[model samples]
Target: MMSDRLFVYGTLMRGYDHPMARLLSSNAEFLGTASIPGRLYLMRHYPALVPSEDPDEHVHGEVFRLHRVDEVLAQLDDYEGCGPSDQRSEYRREISQVTLDGGTELDAFVYYFNWDVARLPRIVSGRFQPEAFSG
Candidate 1:
Protein backbone atom coordinates (compact mmCIF):
# COMPACT_ATOMS: atom_id res chain seq x y z
CA MET A 1 0.00 0.00 0.00
CA MET A 2 1.11 3.54 -0.68
CA SER A 3 1.88 5.78 2.29
CA ASP A 4 0.83 9.40 2.46
CA ARG A 5 3.49 10.23 4.98
CA LEU A 6 6.70 12.06 4.03
CA PHE A 7 9.94 12.44 5.97
CA VAL A 8 12.01 15.59 5.43
CA TYR A 9 15.51 16.02 6.86
CA GLY A 10 16.79 19.05 5.03
CA THR A 11 15.44 22.45 4.01
CA LEU A 12 11.92 21.02 4.04
CA MET A 13 12.01 20.57 7.78
CA ARG A 14 10.14 22.92 10.10
CA GLY A 15 11.73 26.24 11.10
CA TYR A 16 13.27 26.62 7.63
CA ASP A 17 12.25 29.81 5.86
CA HIS A 18 12.41 28.30 2.37
CA PRO A 19 9.37 28.71 0.13
CA MET A 20 9.14 24.95 -0.35
CA ALA A 21 9.17 24.44 3.38
CA ARG A 22 6.30 26.93 3.71
CA LEU A 23 4.45 25.16 0.96
CA LEU A 24 4.86 21.85 2.77
CA SER A 25 3.64 23.28 6.06
CA SER A 26 0.57 24.72 4.35
CA ASN A 27 -0.21 21.54 2.44
CA ALA A 28 0.47 18.84 5.02
CA GLU A 29 0.02 18.02 8.69
CA PHE A 30 3.18 17.79 10.72
CA LEU A 31 3.15 14.49 12.58
CA GLY A 32 6.32 14.93 14.65
CA THR A 33 10.03 14.46 14.67
CA ALA A 34 11.26 11.15 13.33
CA SER A 35 14.47 9.37 12.38
CA ILE A 36 15.68 6.78 9.92
CA PRO A 37 18.86 4.79 9.55
CA GLY A 38 20.93 6.82 7.10
CA ARG A 39 24.04 8.88 6.60
CA LEU A 40 23.73 12.60 5.92
CA TYR A 41 26.09 14.53 3.68
CA LEU A 42 26.50 18.21 2.99
CA MET A 43 25.50 19.07 -0.56
CA ARG A 44 26.44 22.73 -0.53
CA HIS A 45 23.38 24.62 0.68
CA TYR A 46 21.36 21.51 1.41
CA PRO A 47 21.83 18.03 2.85
CA ALA A 48 21.47 14.63 1.25
CA LEU A 49 20.50 11.37 2.95
CA VAL A 50 21.96 8.00 2.02
CA PRO A 51 20.52 4.83 3.47
CA SER A 52 22.76 3.11 5.97
CA GLU A 53 22.83 -0.38 7.46
CA ASP A 54 24.78 0.64 10.55
CA PRO A 55 22.41 0.79 13.49
CA ASP A 56 24.35 3.65 14.96
CA GLU A 57 23.76 5.84 11.94
CA HIS A 58 20.56 7.85 11.95
CA VAL A 59 19.19 10.93 10.21
CA HIS A 60 16.84 13.11 12.22
CA GLY A 61 13.93 14.84 10.60
CA GLU A 62 10.17 15.46 10.70
CA VAL A 63 7.25 13.52 9.30
CA PHE A 64 4.17 14.96 7.64
CA ARG A 65 0.84 13.50 6.65
CA LEU A 66 -0.01 14.75 3.18
CA HIS A 67 -3.43 16.31 2.76
CA ARG A 68 -3.18 16.22 -1.02
CA VAL A 69 -0.73 13.50 -1.86
CA ASP A 70 -0.55 13.89 -5.60
CA GLU A 71 -0.40 17.65 -5.64
CA VAL A 72 2.08 17.92 -2.80
CA LEU A 73 4.34 15.17 -4.06
CA ALA A 74 4.29 16.67 -7.52
CA GLN A 75 5.54 19.98 -6.26
CA LEU A 76 8.07 18.34 -3.93
CA ASP A 77 9.31 16.07 -6.68
CA ASP A 78 9.96 19.03 -8.94
CA TYR A 79 11.62 20.99 -6.18
CA GLU A 80 13.82 18.02 -5.37
CA GLY A 81 14.81 17.79 -9.06
CA CYS A 82 13.55 14.24 -9.39
CA GLY A 83 10.35 14.89 -11.26
CA PRO A 84 9.71 13.23 -14.61
CA SER A 85 10.84 16.35 -16.44
CA ASP A 86 14.21 16.27 -14.76
CA GLN A 87 16.32 14.04 -16.97
CA ARG A 88 19.34 13.89 -14.70
CA SER A 89 17.94 14.10 -11.23
CA GLU A 90 20.18 14.25 -8.25
CA TYR A 91 17.73 12.64 -5.87
CA ARG A 92 15.14 9.91 -5.90
CA ARG A 93 12.03 9.65 -3.76
CA GLU A 94 11.34 6.34 -2.08
CA ILE A 95 9.38 4.85 0.79
CA SER A 96 11.43 4.09 3.85
CA GLN A 97 10.78 3.08 7.45
CA VAL A 98 11.09 5.87 9.97
CA THR A 99 10.90 5.84 13.72
CA LEU A 100 8.98 8.63 15.35
CA ASP A 101 10.09 10.28 18.53
CA GLY A 102 7.65 8.13 20.48
CA GLY A 103 9.18 4.94 19.01
CA THR A 104 6.51 4.32 16.43
CA GLU A 105 7.85 2.84 13.21
CA LEU A 106 6.08 3.61 9.96
CA ASP A 107 6.70 3.88 6.25
CA ALA A 108 7.31 7.37 4.91
CA PHE A 109 8.45 8.77 1.59
CA VAL A 110 11.98 10.15 1.64
CA TYR A 111 14.19 11.85 -0.95
CA TYR A 112 17.63 10.28 -1.10
CA PHE A 113 20.77 11.39 -2.87
CA ASN A 114 21.21 9.71 -6.23
CA TRP A 115 24.75 10.77 -7.00
CA ASP A 116 28.19 10.01 -5.68
CA VAL A 117 29.08 11.46 -2.25
CA ALA A 118 32.65 10.28 -1.98
CA ARG A 119 34.06 13.79 -1.68
CA LEU A 120 31.24 15.33 0.31
CA PRO A 121 31.64 15.91 4.00
CA ARG A 122 29.41 13.76 6.12
CA ILE A 123 27.06 15.28 8.66
CA VAL A 124 28.13 13.02 11.49
CA SER A 125 25.61 14.49 13.91
CA GLY A 126 22.82 13.38 11.61
CA ARG A 127 21.30 16.86 11.83
CA PHE A 128 21.52 19.40 9.03
CA GLN A 129 22.87 22.72 10.23
CA PRO A 130 21.41 25.44 8.05
CA GLU A 131 23.45 28.11 9.71
CA ALA A 132 26.57 26.64 8.19
CA PHE A 133 25.34 27.81 4.81
CA SER A 134 24.30 31.28 5.98
CA GLY A 135 26.48 34.05 4.71
Candidate 2:
Protein backbone atom coordinates (compact mmCIF):
# COMPACT_ATOMS: atom_id res chain seq x y z
CA MET A 1 0.00 0.00 0.00
CA MET A 2 1.09 3.58 -0.49
CA SER A 3 2.63 5.38 2.45
CA ASP A 4 -0.17 6.41 4.82
CA ARG A 5 -0.67 9.30 7.19
CA LEU A 6 0.56 8.79 10.79
CA PHE A 7 -0.24 10.08 14.26
CA VAL A 8 2.14 10.81 17.11
CA TYR A 9 1.07 11.49 20.73
CA GLY A 10 4.05 11.65 23.03
CA THR A 11 7.30 13.55 22.71
CA LEU A 12 6.16 14.69 19.31
CA MET A 13 3.45 16.59 21.16
CA ARG A 14 3.62 20.38 21.27
CA GLY A 15 5.39 22.28 24.07
CA TYR A 16 7.97 19.53 24.11
CA ASP A 17 8.43 20.22 20.40
CA HIS A 18 10.82 17.39 19.91
CA PRO A 19 12.73 17.40 16.58
CA MET A 20 10.36 15.25 14.54
CA ALA A 21 8.23 18.11 13.21
CA ARG A 22 10.89 19.68 10.95
CA LEU A 23 10.95 16.71 8.59
CA LEU A 24 7.19 16.90 8.34
CA SER A 25 7.63 20.35 6.69
CA SER A 26 3.95 21.23 6.50
CA ASN A 27 1.54 21.41 9.39
CA ALA A 28 -0.24 18.20 10.36
CA GLU A 29 -3.95 17.82 10.72
CA PHE A 30 -5.07 17.82 14.35
CA LEU A 31 -7.81 15.28 14.28
CA GLY A 32 -8.63 15.44 17.97
CA THR A 33 -7.78 13.98 21.37
CA ALA A 34 -6.71 10.32 21.44
CA SER A 35 -5.95 7.61 23.96
CA ILE A 36 -4.09 4.31 23.55
CA PRO A 37 -5.91 2.55 26.41
CA GLY A 38 -2.81 2.12 28.54
CA ARG A 39 -0.78 3.72 31.27
CA LEU A 40 1.74 6.32 30.18
CA TYR A 41 4.86 6.89 32.18
CA LEU A 42 7.73 9.31 31.87
CA MET A 43 10.98 7.56 31.05
CA ARG A 44 14.10 9.69 31.17
CA HIS A 45 12.35 12.90 30.13
CA TYR A 46 10.36 10.95 27.55
CA PRO A 47 6.88 9.51 27.79
CA ALA A 48 6.09 5.86 27.16
CA LEU A 49 2.90 3.87 27.25
CA VAL A 50 2.75 0.66 29.23
CA PRO A 51 -0.13 -1.50 28.09
CA SER A 52 -2.38 -2.18 31.02
CA GLU A 53 -5.48 -4.23 31.56
CA ASP A 54 -7.10 -1.60 33.73
CA PRO A 55 -9.92 0.25 32.08
CA ASP A 56 -9.70 3.41 34.16
CA GLU A 57 -6.19 4.24 33.12
CA HIS A 58 -5.71 5.63 29.64
CA VAL A 59 -2.81 7.16 27.74
CA HIS A 60 -3.89 10.68 26.83
CA GLY A 61 -2.49 12.22 23.66
CA GLU A 62 -3.54 14.27 20.69
CA VAL A 63 -4.17 13.00 17.19
CA PHE A 64 -2.39 14.36 14.11
CA ARG A 65 -2.68 12.97 10.59
CA LEU A 66 0.86 13.28 9.28
CA HIS A 67 1.49 13.77 5.57
CA ARG A 68 4.61 13.04 3.50
CA VAL A 69 4.95 9.58 4.97
CA ASP A 70 7.89 8.50 2.77
CA GLU A 71 10.34 11.16 3.85
CA VAL A 72 9.12 11.31 7.42
CA LEU A 73 9.43 7.57 7.87
CA ALA A 74 13.01 7.63 6.61
CA GLN A 75 14.15 10.21 9.14
CA LEU A 76 12.20 8.46 11.89
CA ASP A 77 13.83 5.14 11.09
CA ASP A 78 17.25 6.70 11.28
CA TYR A 79 16.59 8.33 14.62
CA GLU A 80 15.21 5.10 16.04
CA GLY A 81 18.17 3.12 14.66
CA CYS A 82 15.87 0.97 12.62
CA GLY A 83 15.83 0.03 8.94
CA PRO A 84 14.47 -2.65 6.64
CA SER A 85 16.67 -5.31 8.23
CA ASP A 86 16.46 -4.24 11.84
CA GLN A 87 13.11 -4.37 13.63
CA ARG A 88 14.22 -4.54 17.24
CA SER A 89 15.93 -1.32 18.23
CA GLU A 90 15.50 1.84 20.27
CA TYR A 91 11.97 2.31 18.92
CA ARG A 92 9.55 0.47 16.70
CA ARG A 93 6.90 2.08 14.53
CA GLU A 94 3.56 0.42 15.17
CA ILE A 95 0.02 0.83 13.87
CA SER A 96 -2.11 1.24 16.94
CA GLN A 97 -5.78 2.12 17.33
CA VAL A 98 -5.55 5.48 19.03
CA THR A 99 -8.94 6.87 20.06
CA LEU A 100 -9.76 10.52 20.45
CA ASP A 101 -11.37 12.06 23.50
CA GLY A 102 -14.63 12.13 21.59
CA GLY A 103 -14.18 8.44 20.69
CA THR A 104 -13.00 8.90 17.13
CA GLU A 105 -10.90 5.96 15.97
CA LEU A 106 -8.15 6.02 13.38
CA ASP A 107 -5.07 4.15 12.20
CA ALA A 108 -1.79 5.77 13.12
CA PHE A 109 1.88 4.88 13.60
CA VAL A 110 3.03 5.06 17.19
CA TYR A 111 6.73 4.83 17.97
CA TYR A 112 6.84 2.52 20.94
CA PHE A 113 10.28 2.74 22.47
CA ASN A 114 12.07 -0.61 22.73
CA TRP A 115 14.08 0.24 25.79
CA ASP A 116 13.58 -1.63 29.04
CA VAL A 117 11.56 0.41 31.53
CA ALA A 118 13.71 -0.62 34.44
CA ARG A 119 16.93 0.30 32.70
CA LEU A 120 15.78 3.66 31.45
CA PRO A 121 15.63 6.52 33.86
CA ARG A 122 12.10 7.26 34.99
CA ILE A 123 10.85 10.82 35.12
CA VAL A 124 7.97 12.16 37.14
CA SER A 125 4.72 10.75 35.94
CA GLY A 126 2.13 12.99 34.22
CA ARG A 127 4.79 15.43 33.20
CA PHE A 128 4.54 15.91 29.45
CA GLN A 129 1.19 17.11 28.19
CA PRO A 130 0.73 15.16 24.98
CA GLU A 131 -1.55 17.42 22.95
CA ALA A 132 0.37 18.24 19.78
CA PHE A 133 3.05 16.67 17.60
CA SER A 134 4.54 20.08 16.96
CA GLY A 135 4.91 23.29 18.83
Candidate 3:
Protein backbone atom coordinates (compact mmCIF):
# COMPACT_ATOMS: atom_id res chain seq x y z
CA MET A 1 0.00 0.00 0.00
CA MET A 2 1.12 3.53 -0.71
CA SER A 3 2.30 5.58 2.21
CA ASP A 4 1.34 9.17 2.93
CA ARG A 5 4.08 9.76 5.44
CA LEU A 6 7.31 11.61 4.65
CA PHE A 7 10.51 11.90 6.65
CA VAL A 8 12.26 15.24 6.30
CA TYR A 9 15.81 15.66 7.60
CA GLY A 10 17.01 18.91 6.16
CA THR A 11 15.63 22.27 5.09
CA LEU A 12 12.15 20.86 4.99
CA MET A 13 12.09 20.08 8.69
CA ARG A 14 10.21 22.18 11.21
CA GLY A 15 11.64 25.39 12.72
CA TYR A 16 13.06 26.38 9.38
CA ASP A 17 11.76 29.43 7.50
CA HIS A 18 12.06 27.84 4.09
CA PRO A 19 9.06 28.33 1.84
CA MET A 20 8.81 24.64 1.15
CA ALA A 21 8.94 23.98 4.85
CA ARG A 22 5.99 26.28 5.24
CA LEU A 23 4.22 24.47 2.45
CA LEU A 24 4.76 21.21 4.28
CA SER A 25 3.54 22.54 7.62
CA SER A 26 0.38 23.80 6.02
CA ASN A 27 -0.37 20.57 4.20
CA ALA A 28 0.76 17.85 6.59
CA GLU A 29 0.31 16.76 10.14
CA PHE A 30 3.53 16.67 12.15
CA LEU A 31 3.64 13.20 13.66
CA GLY A 32 6.81 13.68 15.68
CA THR A 33 10.55 13.35 15.70
CA ALA A 34 11.91 10.18 14.16
CA SER A 35 15.11 8.51 13.13
CA ILE A 36 16.17 6.25 10.33
CA PRO A 37 19.25 4.15 9.78
CA GLY A 38 21.49 6.46 7.82
CA ARG A 39 24.25 9.02 7.89
CA LEU A 40 23.80 12.69 7.19
CA TYR A 41 26.18 14.67 5.01
CA LEU A 42 26.34 18.42 4.67
CA MET A 43 25.54 19.56 1.16
CA ARG A 44 26.00 23.32 1.21
CA HIS A 45 22.96 24.91 2.79
CA TYR A 46 21.16 21.60 3.13
CA PRO A 47 21.95 18.05 4.23
CA ALA A 48 21.67 14.70 2.56
CA LEU A 49 20.80 11.26 3.92
CA VAL A 50 22.95 8.29 2.95
CA PRO A 51 21.78 4.90 4.06
CA SER A 52 24.05 3.24 6.58
CA GLU A 53 24.38 -0.33 7.74
CA ASP A 54 25.94 0.50 11.11
CA PRO A 55 23.40 -0.06 13.84
CA ASP A 56 24.64 3.01 15.71
CA GLU A 57 24.28 5.27 12.71
CA HIS A 58 21.02 7.10 12.39
CA VAL A 59 19.72 10.32 10.86
CA HIS A 60 17.41 12.40 12.99
CA GLY A 61 14.40 14.13 11.49
CA GLU A 62 10.65 14.60 11.62
CA VAL A 63 7.86 12.56 10.08
CA PHE A 64 4.67 13.98 8.67
CA ARG A 65 1.41 12.54 7.42
CA LEU A 66 0.62 14.30 4.17
CA HIS A 67 -2.96 15.51 3.90
CA ARG A 68 -2.75 16.20 0.17
CA VAL A 69 -0.39 13.51 -0.94
CA ASP A 70 -0.28 14.09 -4.66
CA GLU A 71 -0.24 17.87 -4.51
CA VAL A 72 2.31 18.12 -1.78
CA LEU A 73 4.58 15.46 -3.21
CA ALA A 74 4.49 17.00 -6.65
CA GLN A 75 5.79 20.31 -5.34
CA LEU A 76 8.24 18.61 -3.02
CA ASP A 77 9.54 16.47 -5.86
CA ASP A 78 10.48 19.57 -7.79
CA TYR A 79 11.88 21.31 -4.74
CA GLU A 80 14.00 18.26 -3.92
CA GLY A 81 15.25 18.23 -7.50
CA CYS A 82 13.95 14.74 -8.15
CA GLY A 83 10.99 15.49 -10.32
CA PRO A 84 10.38 13.54 -13.52
CA SER A 85 11.75 16.40 -15.60
CA ASP A 86 14.99 16.52 -13.71
CA GLN A 87 17.38 14.58 -15.95
CA ARG A 88 19.97 14.26 -13.23
CA SER A 89 18.26 14.29 -9.90
CA GLU A 90 20.27 14.90 -6.77
CA TYR A 91 17.89 12.99 -4.51
CA ARG A 92 15.51 10.07 -4.92
CA ARG A 93 12.40 9.54 -2.86
CA GLU A 94 12.21 6.08 -1.36
CA ILE A 95 10.14 4.26 1.22
CA SER A 96 11.96 3.40 4.41
CA GLN A 97 11.22 2.48 7.99
CA VAL A 98 11.54 5.22 10.56
CA THR A 99 11.30 4.89 14.30
CA LEU A 100 9.54 7.64 16.18
CA ASP A 101 10.64 8.96 19.52
CA GLY A 102 7.80 7.08 21.15
CA GLY A 103 9.12 3.84 19.67
CA THR A 104 6.60 3.50 16.91
CA GLU A 105 7.95 2.34 13.58
CA LEU A 106 6.35 3.21 10.27
CA ASP A 107 7.07 3.33 6.58
CA ALA A 108 7.74 6.83 5.31
CA PHE A 109 9.00 8.48 2.19
CA VAL A 110 12.61 9.63 2.44
CA TYR A 111 14.61 11.71 0.04
CA TYR A 112 18.03 10.14 -0.14
CA PHE A 113 21.14 11.49 -1.74
CA ASN A 114 21.69 9.89 -5.11
CA TRP A 115 25.29 10.92 -5.73
CA ASP A 116 28.54 9.77 -4.19
CA VAL A 117 29.17 11.12 -0.67
CA ALA A 118 32.86 10.33 -0.68
CA ARG A 119 34.02 13.95 -0.75
CA LEU A 120 31.39 15.46 1.51
CA PRO A 121 31.79 15.97 5.23
CA ARG A 122 29.51 13.70 7.17
CA ILE A 123 27.32 15.20 9.90
CA VAL A 124 28.59 12.90 12.59
CA SER A 125 25.78 13.94 14.92
CA GLY A 126 23.24 12.52 12.50
CA ARG A 127 21.36 15.79 12.74
CA PHE A 128 21.34 18.72 10.41
CA GLN A 129 22.31 22.05 11.97
CA PRO A 130 21.52 25.03 9.82
CA GLU A 131 24.14 27.08 11.61
CA ALA A 132 26.74 24.86 10.00
CA PHE A 133 26.02 26.71 6.80
CA SER A 134 26.44 30.17 8.26
CA GLY A 135 29.23 32.21 6.76
Model 2 C-alpha lDDT per residue in residues 19-87, reported as the tens digit of each score: 765444354666776777555556544576655577666667666766666676888778655556575
Candidate whose TM-score is highest: 3
Sort the predicted structures by TM-score, highest score first.
3, 1, 2
Clashes of 3: 0
Candidate 2 segments whose C-alpha is farther than 4 A from its true place: 1-3, 25-27, 119-135
Pairs with backbone N, CA or C atoms under 3 Å apart (clashes), candidate 2: 13-132, 14-132, 33-100
- Residue 104, model 1: Cα distance from true site in angstroms: 0.3
Which 10 residues in a row give candidate 3 its minimum summed lDDT? 80-89
Candidate 3 local lDDT, residue 75: 97
Error of 1 at 57 (Å): 0.2
Candidate 3 TM-score, C-alpha based: 0.95
Candidate 1 error regions (>4 Å): 84-87
Kindly list the per-residue Cα lDDT of model 1 for residues 4-123, writing each as its tens digit.
999999999999889999999999999999999999999988999999999999999999999999999999998998855564699999899999999999999999998899999899
